[model samples]
Target chain A: MAEVTFDKVRKAFGSAVAVRELDLAIRSGEFVSLLGPSGCGKTTTLRMLAGLETPTSGAISIDGTVVNELAPAKRDIAMVFQSYALYPHMSVAQNIAYPLKKRGVSRADRDVRVAAVAATLQLGALLDRKPRQLSGGQQQRVALGRALVRDPRVFLLDEPLSNLDAKLRAHMRAELIELHRRIGKTMVYVTHDQLEAMTMSDRIAVMHDGVLQQFGTPKEVYETPANLFVASFIGSPGMNLVKGELRAAGSGLAFVRGDLSLPVANGGTAGAAVTLGVRPEDITLGAGPFACTIRVVEPTGHETIVMAEAAGETLVARAAPDSQLVPGQVVPFAVRAQRLHAFDADGRRLPLVFAQSNGA
Target chain B: MRNRSLTSRILLNVLAWSIVFVIAFPLVWMILTSVKPQFELFRIPPTILPQEVTFEHYHRVLVETPFLKYFRNSVILAVGTTVLVIVIATLGAHSLVRFSYPGRERLAQLVLFTYLLPSVVLIIPLYLLMVWLGIANTLFSLMLAYTTFALPFALWLLRSFMQGIPQDLEAAALVDGASRMEAFVDVILPQAVPGIISTALFTFILAWNEYLYALVLVNTDEARPLTTGVMNMLITAFNIEWSLLMAASVMMSLPVIIVFALLQKHLTRGFGAGGVKG
Candidate 1:
């Protein structure tokens, strides 16, 4: 296993930059995900690490050795593409054994190693089947098996689970976590799915528009998003953000916008413009200090997502699945005080101190 | 309604069969004419079927004329041209599809442009070049001449075929410790096998059926292929032997038929497996 680092790496395709000023260090044997939307340089970053695309500037090092000029074969890294990229012409066994053959492994050793990998991946029965003859999940395993046969220093996966169906993606996600645990290799997984990053990564590096927005553990990013982008991008149903200004309330501060006022536990410059952020689950829909008219109610089995309008701003709150909240019904709501987030006008998170007594 | 549908189905089948018969009639006539006796070809109005089947025309063509020698020369020219052209085109197509260089797209378009030029326009210069090189009147000269046209056609065809192969497969191979060339041999070449087979078949047929260059370039029996050699039999003879010429034409088509039979499976598989998804 090796620690991988991207030091001020920037990639440009002629004039347009794909990744800019990327500085990330992944610990050895850690499963870290590069999470972002499409065209956000996540795949480009992964390709750069795999030596598939050369970074336009800066250095990428593996195990303290810079690999900017090294060929992909010499980098000792294995990658699983989003399409799986199993060799269509080769049988499963031949596909898995290819890297070993290139490494000059003898036939006997290659067979033994391939058999061991096949058994690990439960692909023994599919050894003779071609890639097209296999199912999507099976092809995915063969792609993984091909990568695993080399046992390289690091594994780079570019949205490897995106092609699978939802159920299979979830199953494979758990399997990948177990595989990472067993192999203990430095794995750099690139994905746009925030849930995948939150579930599988030891640390998540959230990126947007070619810039690294936040890099922290899953809970750290979820509970304490570094900026407005991370705060809104990291959650299901997304965090509700209302534009307003901080004003002096009784003792502390209150965020005020027209007819709505909510006492906040944080101190900011009085009369300064700020956006109040709250998670859907942290908003109590039945009773609170603020009143809002329900605009839409989305029932998701265990929880119902309710979209409401308050003081001309839309807010989404999660309610019990059995709740009978309907559109256009005015309801009193309360936001968990300590669970609130405050961002400045520039979309940067402002530090907020929440005392224990401020809890709802 | 069921009866009406059945009537339309029958009419469709009749139309389809008529089209097939129209396309196949010449080939069927050739085979039948090759087997019929010379007397039966012009008897009265002409018989739809031969009353007496004889191998006399086949026997005379094989023994009396230099048909076997011409067949051997055709085989050499076709196989040699195919091997040479496919080797160059496969690599050229791969480079065009995968690599980036200055004027690469323009170069691909230029290759197709070369193929668009009629061979009749090129034969004179080609013949002069072959004579200057001292290889004229030889099978090697014809092979070189065939490649001028065949290479461009093969390269253009194989480029699109190679483009259908996903780039991720090569990247996956490279990341799996295979060098660029090694990955190409192991991954790209195997995926391109169907395309290569089809291109080879096309190149072989073009070389085998070429007459203008063969007629102008080579006059010796040692180097003349079946196309020009068969045509020479028609003009040089005292009397036109229709059955004999038909027999030679039948024999000339056998190799292509056999090659198509052998590679038919791969050709069909190529269409179905054009791209790798998921």
Candidate 2:
């Protein structure tokens, strides 16, 4: 296992910058995820770490050794592509043993190593089958087995679970977590799915438009998003953000936008434009300072997502699954003040002072 | 309903068999003509089957003429052309599909454009070039001339086949500690087997039947392939020996027919797999 670092790395493809001024230091044996939507440079960053792509500027080092000029084979890194990319012509056993053969491993050692990997992935029965003969989940295991047989220093996965069905994705997600725990290798997983990052990563590097938005533990990023992008992008329904101006209210400040005003204990200049963010689960329905009419209600078995209009702005809140909420019904709701987040006009997070819960 | 369906199935089979017979009539006639006695050719209305079968034509062509020498030359030329063209085209196609050099796309288009050019138009310039190189009458020269056309055709066909292979397979191999060349051998080549076999068959057929270049470039009986050699038999003979020519024609087609039979599975699979997904 090795610690990987990208020091001010930037990649440009003929003037269009894919990644810019990216700096990340992943510790040895840590499972970190680069989370972003499409075209956010997450995949490019992972490719750079794998030596598949060269950073236009800056250095990428593995275990204190810079690998900018090294070939992918010499980098000692293994990658699992999103497509699984099992060789169609080779049987499962041959696919798993390909890397060893290339490295000139003896036939006996290759067989033993391939058998061990196959047993780990429960692929012993399918060893003689070709890649096209196997199901998608089986192909995924073969791809993983190929990567694992090398025991490379770092494992780079590019949206490896995106192709599987929902139940299989969840199952494989748990399996990957277990695999990581057992192997204790430095794994850099690239994914647009925030749930995968939140569930599996020891630290999540949230990115947007070639910029690193936030890099922290899952809870830290969820509860204390570094900016408006992270605040809005990290949740299921995402955090509800409303544009308002901060005004003096008694000893503290009250965020005001037309008919909707809520007291906020935040350090911001009065009359300054700011955006207030509240998590869907933190907004309790039926009682508080704000009154709103319901717009849409989506019950997703476990919880009900309530969309309501407050002062011409739509706010989403999570409520009980069996809640009797309908459109056009006026309901009073409270924003958990201590759990609230305020961002400046530039979308950077502003310091919020914790106060008593504004729950009714 | 069952009787009507049976009638329609019979009609379809008859139609299909008629088409097959029309296609195969010439080949059947050639074999029969080769076995018929020489005098049967001019018997009023021509006999479809000879009154007596004779091996006299085959024996004369095999023993009395230089048929064996020309057969050996054709074999050398076709096999050499196929091997040379396939080796060069495989590497060229892989580079064109996988690498991104400047003008790579334009080069692939140029290769197709060369294949589209008629070989008749190229014969004169190729003849002069062969003479200048001082290797005019050798089988090696014919192999070189054949490559001029076969290389581009093979490259164009194999390029499409290589393109069907997913790029991720090579990327996976590279990340699994295989170098680029190693990945080409282990991953790309095996996937392109059917395609390569079909391309080799095409190149061989092209070199085997080529006549104009052989007629123009080589004058000696020493270097003459069957196409020119057999034509010489008719031109130099006192009588027009149709039976001997027919027998030699049948002999000339046997190798190609045998090769096609051996690789028929890969050939059809190549047509489907190369044109579609890998």
Best by TM-score: 2
Docking quality band of candidate 2, CAPRI definitions: medium
Q: Report lDDT per candidate.
A: 0.90, 0.91
Judged by whole-model lDDT over C-alpha atoms, candidate 1 comes out at 0.90
Q: Which segments of candidate 2 are over 4 A away from where they belong?
A: A250-252, A354-360, B1-22
| Per-model TM-score of chain B | 0.92, 0.92
For every candidate in turn, the CA RMSD to the true structure comes to 3.3, 2.4
- Please give, for residues A10-76, the per-residue lDDT of candidate 2 as tens digits: 9998789999999999999999999999999999999898877889999999999999999888998
Per-residue lDDT for B1-278 in model 2, tens only?
99999999999999999999999999999899999998897788889988899999999999999999999999999999999999999999999998887899999998889888888899889888988999888998899999998898799889989999899888888888888898898889998999999999999999999999899888899999999999997666477788998999999999999999999999998877777855
Q: Candidate 1, which segments miss by more than 4 Å at Cα?
A: A248-254, A262-267, A285-288, A299-301, A320-331, A354-360, B1-54, B237-243, B268-278
fnat, candidate 1?
0.95
DockQ of each: 0.72, 0.73
Give the per-residue lDDT of model 1 (tens digit) for A176-263: 9999999999999999999999999999999999999999999999999888999999999999998989888778877778787777
